[model samples]
Target: MASDVEDGVCFHCLQPIPHGVELSVAFQGDDKAVCCAGCQAVAETIIEHGLTAYYKHRDLDKPQQTPLLPEQLKELDVYDNPDVQSDFVRNTGDHSKQTTLTVNNITCGACAWLIERELAKTPGMIKSVVNVSNQRLHIEWDGSIIKLSDIIARLARIGYQALPFQQNQIEANINARRKGFIKRLGVAGLATMQVMMIAFALYFGVVSDLDPTTQQYLWVVSLVFATPVILYSGQPFYKSALKSIQAGSVNMDVPVSIALIGAYIASLYAVIIGRGEVYFESISMFTFFLLTGRFLELLAKEKALKFSTNRLTYMPNLAHREYDGGLEDIAAKQLKINDIIVIKPGETIPADGVLLSDKASVDESLLTGESRPVTKATGDGIVAGSVNQSATLRIKVTATAQQTVLAGIVAMQDAALADKPKVQKAIDHIAQYFVMTLLAIAAVTFLVWSWFDPDHALWVTLAVLVATCPCALSLAAPTSITGAVHRLNRMNVLVKGAQLLESVKHLDTVVFDKTGTLTYGQFKLIAREDYADIDTINAIVSGLEQRSEHPIAAALSQLSDQPISPDAIQNYPGQGILAEIAGTDYRLGRCEFIQIWHPNWQPKRQSNVILANRQAVLAEFQVDDEVREDSHDVICA
Candidate 1:
């Protein structure tokens, strides 16, 4: 390789260096040929850290072929401003700011690992984690010393593009990925059917003593159909395998790519020579099934991530802000600190602010996991994402869009995703070595069969490669963990780390931080009128109750034995509902709701639903929070 360097060979990658290159570096007292300025910079960084041992270590590993740009070395002072950093950066109580960036051009796990390693070398950087599944990088650094743009620039220099993470961008990327996979799957499925039909016809013709020319023609047609199935649908596996090998590690894709390419090459040679048997049908079938499994798995991952995107819903799309001496509608992201915003009943609070009104009740179930509404008075601080249950109020904004406590929680969750749990790390360590062991076994099988049955050696080796590909083995743990996460998310139980699953199993006792954690904290029926009269009233009461989502409406809805059909249901924002049920035209809501229709009806002032007709009071339902039936069983378990 050193002799060929003078003839335009790269000393670092050992590939033919292109012309118009002035890149060179001195290593071990000799001038080495580098393909570009990026290679020279990487070589210098490795040697500067006394990591020249990697040069000798990577000799047996495949060299990287990624193209890097030199223009990314420009200064990044703009990111140091606090206003610009507020868009995507979150503060963790001190000078440290955490940011999650979506990266492009990540082909495999090694690319993520390389980006992480390079980022850790920067000054004032606390830590960097790269999630290979989504190609997202989570970084925490001190803003006082380093800026956000510097980290992004470093990633660009190493053949990757880094930008502030956005949900819409990720959704678009997922759609594109799904479309590509579906198209490939369709092509492979169609090709497999055509090839299998040709193969069956050829086999039957042999028994019927068909002519040689017709059999050759059918074989040629089958080869043409199988070609696209192997090259197009099977391309992803080969690309992943190459990246893994270049990074000095082996992944499950190595064996899969080998099996696919090997079978295609063998079958292609057989068809061209017209003497050996062809396995065109077998190759096409395998490719189709593989693509099908991969597409389904991709969909499952997309759904799992979709559950996580709910965190973004905390920020409202629009906010009512004080502007030009009156309230005006504006995008939530445009709101600045000290801006006063009005929030109505049942509306989600758009930002963290201080209450400017006398009193209000807010339900912060999304953040605190508490079902009961908490009361707040004037000058009290309110959090973003909490619902204003009752009473409209004005609040002065204290934090911007990405700097709120809710955004901080989202940033923490993302940071947790980038870190590997103990069990996951162990699994990854075992998987890396397992790939090497399989390669060795395949080699031994080939040599043993070549001694006695030389013609069957390649066939036996291919079978071994396919049978022990390790795809299922590597996927088993992640799939189970992902399903568990989906189930827990539905229950409002958020788990940030995978190791928590194993760790919780070994605990002697479990603890909850709040009352709602162990109890339902929802209203249950406490008192009612006579059943004979209540049953008749409940049938009419279910009409208005079913239409409202209020907790009281839900509690009342559970009393009726059957669902009642109601018509002309009208909702009053701050008061209640008025509907015509069974042509009785009853009103079931607060005392005010009944008084609106009947001026003489005087209902008691208490926590109860007033049910009345046009003339008199019919029945009243009382409710309160009671301990859940399953709470005791759950505590014991």
Candidate 2:
């Protein structure tokens, strides 16, 4: 291979390296010749990410192709253009621009720490925060000191690819990220199991009559199996540790990475010297567990985000706007106040508006908790996110996009998330110094062990670092809050912030609003007084109620399982029902209407409906609000 490379062949692609060409890539501490800038970039990207082992692990016959860029990269420069920036980037202040980007290949909190640390060193950076759960990078920077493209290019060098966040593509990005984590975790799990099997065989070799060469062979096999676990599955730990140290700070990952790598190196050295013990199983197991914890956190964060986005999903990207003389579909965000828009049957309302049509039936369950369709007439106000359940209607816009009520709910969720609880802020402050203290303990451990027993100093120190890394303390708090909020959303409770969660333990007096909160808004039959035969009452009431569209009619309709046809029925809107059955006139309505027939008759109890004839009162009916199933338990708890 060396002679072939010396004969004018590119070291990477095996293509002919042109005479006097100067392209090269650093690999394994040496420069290797390449055919062009593309080959150079590809080689450098591979090496810088600690993936140079791919050069050896890959099949020999694999074809090499290149798509790379030079130091003055052109592809990233497109992001610097104002047109490209307009999609995701926005000006927050005169000198500051902020954006949210989906970051690729983040496995844990340490990756977030690394990104933040590096960005803080840049000249123009104001702030950079990584949401480990969503794998998103939120950045704010001053434009005077650096360009946005340059910041992105800096991320590329640190082994991450970032793109402007697109809501339509969020689920796809989440799936891809989940798949990558699963792949890495699976590799670590399988490799750990195999190494443990080998570990048992090596233990047998030590205590039994196994030959020296056989024991050596088992150790070598363990090394081979553990290599991938350390290099690929455990890549994020090492990467984060290096960046943390380079930034003159310490992260929880620093101790973990040091312990894991230290063990591997120590075991490898012992293997080569043909003496001492190996800990491949320990290394493999650590990688698997760390990945499992991060995966769970990712899932919890995803669930929280889903609950938050459920409201926003009702917003349609386009709305039918009445333009000049014809209807045109335009971006919903472009809609303005008083803009007339057409809503078809079964389509969601694009904005809050007033009805221009004579009449329409709308399903407002998504916006309001009410399940029944509301009947709206001309000049009645309608809100966005309601579905038109009847005929097509034209509405004049009152609020569009973010100005709508649905957007306010979404914004409240964002505001709640932004306002961190006192405990979380305190924990964050402690966690910063937590790693430094762990390092101090490690230093004390190393020095004490070195004086007592020189040979075991490194091993004991590594064990201390690994056993007490404090990873769970730093991760558990925020994820628990997110998970709690998500669970509450499932129960139809909207939690504004972590303050509610933190203060739950001290909850004393619980006050609840009556209708639609503690109790269902739909009326429930409570009591009834009858002066007429039960059979006659059931048939007549069912017939009368079946004719009207009012909500109370449905409740009264339940008074009978079977329906009876009345000779004639008439509905007095917002009043009562008038019907005739068996040559008798029946009135089911206001007590005042009943009093007209019986001048001295009066109701003895509180009632919703009074059934009477011209002679006397026949029956009285009462309704009560139905309470929710959990209302009692919630109050007591």
Candidate 3:
């Protein structure tokens, strides 16, 4: 009867209905429920079955703002259970007590202030920092009493989610960056085109040369069109320049900012003076080109940041924290110094710590850029961010999360912002004198041309200023750096930055690690000698060696090819293994273990192994290692 748009489109059904058509679907909030009478009945049944929140949260297609209050979190029974609390405390160590979460949900400085105020209300929270650009929060809190889950759940209630570092989320994060860049680029491009069109009309005497009054009218039109371009399209440059100035550093944006501001003021001056001959089109075009370059640079930087961030985030979200004769998985961030953590095979070590269990081969390639795995034994120190390749390890954390190698990588990335390429330095050098040189040339030209013709001086000065713009100089460095970076990326060698490329090109010496880098460090069995009644020796050596991750152990295991179990096995560091099988005892290792029989015998190389009984040498095994196929070429190249 109302004949309103809302009545025509059924609020619940979300479909246009004839004026007399009956609709049975019920509407809630701002969402439409599209259904027939029977379907509406089913929908109501679903909502009554505790699915209303699901529909409401889903209908909005936005993150639900369901804040978990501290009291509710406590009731979740997380704090009451000493075992759970101790597990979390042990895994995160005492360092979690001093750390705080800095959240990224603060959309602006005002939002940041508001979140900080809320966090400050909570006891034991020393600080809350928010970085809006990356959408990260740094929080410091006392772990002795408060818990990280409580903090995270509290943030979630306020419409912000605290995302722990994780590798699986990398693709989504990268996509978001790409989308943001595309949106900004689109807006800047559209504004650039509109401004250019207005500038062109004013430049070519389209409507400006009609009459004095008409020229004034045209000037107003140009100003109206250009305002959006300078404000919206040029905002990034202005912001970047201001940030650099505040930090007392010079970035590429500083010169671009100067140029844009100068062009805007000069163009406005021309309009006021009733002179439309000046090339304001050039200024608009320059802004557009400069912004295009900046967008490309930002895209490149985002890609690099994403790659390094993903690497740092590869550690598991939770770690098994050891407590009074048991273990429980807790958030990795809660891990503290001196906490024992059990790492299963194929799991990454989450923090820098000391290995408590014996023998683990860890892949440190991601952090050190090395391709080989390092064998770590009991009492050996393990760096954070390295991947455990083969055996399970239990480690006592020596440093907290923020004090580990992963944190160092994060710090290095932050410091790398100041790292500039060779091309940027060249541009900076040119920019230093560009403004002064242009002014001097314009002044000389004006004085020289005034004697010949009074009107010619202004034209000469404008010509010098316009033609001598630093477009070519700006293009020179970025073009080369971009090409080099692209080429290097194609080759699978990710140079950290353009500055690193210079270091690569000028490298005077190259170093190689002898063990895995130059040679296949894995051992291969050449041959084995047989002896009577020595099946026991074979069985004992193989069983004891299976427990060892050393290259020699691997070689022996392959040669024996027999299922053997040692009655008892003991490892002697820097020597070898002692084992007993059946009624016989055996030792497998250095020549010193068999030196009683062959006192004059010495190993030809480090790869040889000797077998002996109490009275005589029984057998000897020879092993050899060969260089990697690429070793020669890598050295020569």
- Top-scoring candidate (lDDT): 2
> Pick by TM-score: which candidate is best?
1
Give per-residue CA lDDT, model 3, range 1-637, as digits (tens): 1112253443322333433334344435333433233224334444444444433433322222322222333354333233333322223235443232224322222333335556777776755654323344556577655666667666655545554432222233444445655665666566556666765665666644666676676666766666666777677667655654453333345555665666677668778897735444555666667667655654554454344433545666679999998999886767888899998766888888998886777878667655446877889999888877655688999865556766656534432422446556645456535645766776788798998887556655665665675545644454455455645555444455557766777888977765555766555666666454567556656677778755556677654568478778766644666676676666677688667556886655453676665555556677555568899899999
* Whole-model lDDT values for every prediction: 0.72, 0.73, 0.57
Candidate 2: what lDDT?
0.73
Cα displacement (Å) at residue 169, model 1: 2.5
Worst 10 residues of 1 by lDDT: 67-76
lDDT of 2 at 550: 56
Candidate 1 lDDT, 412-441, residue by residue in tens: 777766676666555655766777899999
- Residue 26: error of model 1 in Å? 51
Score candidate 3 by lDDT. Answer: 0.57
**Rank order (by lDDT, best first):** 2, 1, 3
Residue pairs in clash, model 2: none
State how far residue 144 of model 1 sits from its true place (Å).
4.9
Q: List the residue pairs that clash in candidate 1.
A: none
